[model samples]
Target: MSAWQDDATRDLMGLGGRLALLVRGEGSAVWDADGNRYLDFLGGIAVNSLGHAHPTFVNAVSQQAAVLSHVSNYFATPQQLELAATLKRLAGTGEAGRVFFANSGTEANETAVKLARLHGNKVGKKGLVSLNHAFHGRSMGALSLTPKPLYQDAFRPLLPDVTYIDNTLEALDELDWSDVAAIFIEPIQGEAGVVEHPAGFLRRARELATENNALLIVDEVQTGMGRTGDWFAFQREGIVPDAMTLAKGIAGGFPLGALVTFGEASELFYPGTHNSTFGGNPLATAVGLAVVAEVENNDLLANVVTRGEQLRAAVTDLPLVTGTSGKGLLIGIHLDGPHAGAVREAAHRRGLIVNAPTDDIIRIAPAYTIGDAEVEEFTRLFAAALADVNGTASEENNA
Candidate 1:
């Protein structure tokens, strides 16, 4: 019997099914408990920025843990202060900004929501806006901003005065933004089949938010920290958001999230407004500093662009693949039919890890350090999996 079938296993909330019991991982590859090796393209759902056990990340975490791991928010640590400054510098906000640390993207977003609400209180605007397919987080405030019915239906009675609109310039023009407090958007929607915001859409949102006195909150949990070939995907469009939430890859697999605020939004919070006991602790921030250094020193941003283009080119023409979407390592392969699940299963049998976010979409977020040979190998395995699935479908049709 499988480990999952054990009677002692608790029926806690989780993803649909357990795929494999991973025992060890290193540099974009993992080995299962059963001794099968698999190339990891999902990267812990885009959390493993530098891949498993990178020397820099490993050393930093190890050394920091030995010294000091956790310190209450009442006290200050040099690592936390340095990490916040580094984030501000990377954002180009300079001294006009500040950061709030949390343990995950959801908490970071919760902090952003609080900031927006406080800012809105000054102008008497309590409403919030978000995209139709946008995903902020699963917390009550963030969930209210998220537009997915499946996740929001049971969590009814979410935060009130939140509106969801389609990601289009026309929709923006039609939006009644007079009462809106903030507009939350993902530069590239990860959970919604990797849907990207349209060209000039972010700029338009910036203008609308300014006109309506609403805060612009960009959720960069999946696209930030060089995941989209740039330090942040929103940078490509050349628009500055009042506040941005970051997580996933921020600390290169460490559990850390940050809410960075710029301009007037930076001073929205006062003493006792918000705090986290474990946020930005010595261990997490120390590793975060190291991750930023490695990404810059190793010049992984250039590699991301080159490898991203190469991957798209290699997969777009494969059999059954209708098209490929997204930028950098955050890629989505659209199949011509509802065969994404079958294709994923076939890839698994062949020792590859991928994610089917939707019935027709396969999302791939390989490590930023993935090499040319690994990409080529993944493409070969994926093409073979497509052929196997297509062949099986043909047999079923004839039968």
Candidate 2:
């Protein structure tokens, strides 16, 4: 094993084993310690919204650090106030909307959980609902909503009154919404192999939640910030969730998370209900502002749309690929067999970076700003890797 890998294994709790000692990155590419360059198709699990080391993101952090970094939420800064307004604007939450910033997707979801609890306390409803096969987060509250045995078994005696259902209208229909305080839904279950809810599922969920006065909280931690061809995945369904959690790509790789509340849901939290020491610190919010502005000014969502279709088209016909799922930049390459792990290794060895979220699904969520060159290079590397593994090429090969 490499020296860095040994050191990492001794120190870090995750990463399985260090795949590469990534030293530097620019645009849509990264270089390992040994100077091996690879196209970054994973984009830090879709966190690197502007790709690695974007100038705007860098400048924002530097400028904010120089001016002000943290005030412990006792006093708000310009970045904090501005970011809140920007988020509300983007979410179309109007004047009644409110924002609470945290440091990660998990933290954002945790805040949403608090909102759910607050709703329960305010009314007679106390039940919380989340979908099966969903990946909310690993924290106690978020984990309770995540029904998977592997993640939940070790952390037994989780939050109570949490129910799980599939992301289908039929599943939603069976639920007694009046008893539920909140229903947490993800437009696309990114960690669950980029699985998307059925068509009209979100809209139907909205109707049911409204009819019974249940809070509909959308977890856009993975699917938001234009990853799914829209500002937020819920936008595609034309539904405004009662509350929404956002992170991952929000700060262009900076550690930032936000809980956005809509309408009456904004009234759920009082002053003493929540606090985070480093949440929405000036440095993080400034970076977030820069990232969001860059996306808006550059029209990167359109790029995500075109690049996603381009990359998906380039790879769907590959020998080992069965089909593709998800939307825009967030895509899952379905394999013919349970060879996602093998294909991931093969792709990594061939100077491409992807991940196997499941035995049969290789998730690819690249930079939203990826262009023709990046797409073409990704195709070449991915195809060569697939050929290396299965030794088959399509008659309609484009690479």
Candidate 3:
């Protein structure tokens, strides 16, 4: 067998049966071993927010590597401090915020869950609540906070005192709020087909948590950093979570994550409570600060808003499309039938890229800087795929 085939065969089967193409990538494009170039709509599942090989990101990483890279948690680094300051400002945490850095989304969420529990203990609460269809992370702690059974079923005996609630404020009704440690939620349900909680659901959750003395932890790992055309998605909802976990786009594809806490909640993580050896490494934080600066200076959030409207408008009138859900660039189009996989395959054949988490929903989280022409191209290609599938069905019926 060929080397690539051998590698594929040896790989684990944990990816839900979806095999990936081995490719060489460059800004918004990837070439398979067979020299097929595809426009990458997936963008490493929304991690490459700055596209690929962005000059600013490249320069920042190079410069920081020359200066310093890793320092143990015992010592402070200027890059880490600067990045934390920038994030605090972006998150609107004012002067009362503090940050704990980690190396990935799961670690970031792990930190958030731990801090929530600590805060709950401080206030004498006992339980925690998260929405159904939510995905926080894969670690035991974050996994416990994740409500999806399929993801959690395999790993039983997760942390105790974690409960699942519906994605509506009504789900909070009649609960003994006094025992709830905190209410954790994602701004947008990225993995569960981009489901969004109802309007005012977040605000109402905040109100309930405050009334009952609980913390509100917003998992913005996938929805923050202009992915939804805002610094943070919760800002648009008019609610500020007590604690927030961020990753994915924070470092523009570098492995980095952070937990930011405001008010008295920042004191939950006392010294010696938690630490990551490579968490706030100079290289990652330096790259992160650059990503944040680029986002602000280039006004990429504005671009996300403009391009999101174009992409949504192009598909709003399609017969096969039921509707598009989400805000800004993190969009999900619901289709009339379970043809998401087929449509995605067809788009791939046509040198386009997309994802299907559900049988009928196609998730489109392309880089925020994706151009209008690319969006138009994807819309045309998707429409063609839909028509082709319908035509095939009609012919089969006639035969």
lDDT for 155 (candidate 1)? 83
lDDT of 2 by residue, 1-399 (tens): 989877888888973656899999999999999999999999999999999999999899888888888889888899899999999999999999999999999999999999999998888889999999999999999999998898999889999999999888899999877689999998999888999778899999999998888999999999999998899999989989999999999998999999999999999899889999999999999999999999999999999999999988998788888889999999999988777887899999999999998998999999888899999999999888888767532433444
Q: What CA root-mean-square deviation does each model show from the true structure? A: 1.3, 3.2, 1.8
Clashes of 3: 1
Q: Give the TM-score of candidate 2.
A: 0.96
Candidate 3 — worst ten consecutive residues by lDDT sum? 13-22
Worst 10 residues of 1 by lDDT: 6-15
> All candidates' TM-scores?
0.97, 0.96, 0.95
Measured on C-alpha atoms, candidate 1 has an lDDT of 0.92
lDDT per residue as tens, model 3, 324-369: 9988888999988888888888778788788998898999888877
lDDT of each: 0.92, 0.92, 0.86
By TM-score, rank the candidates, best first: 1, 2, 3
Off by over 4 Å in 3: 11-20, 393-399
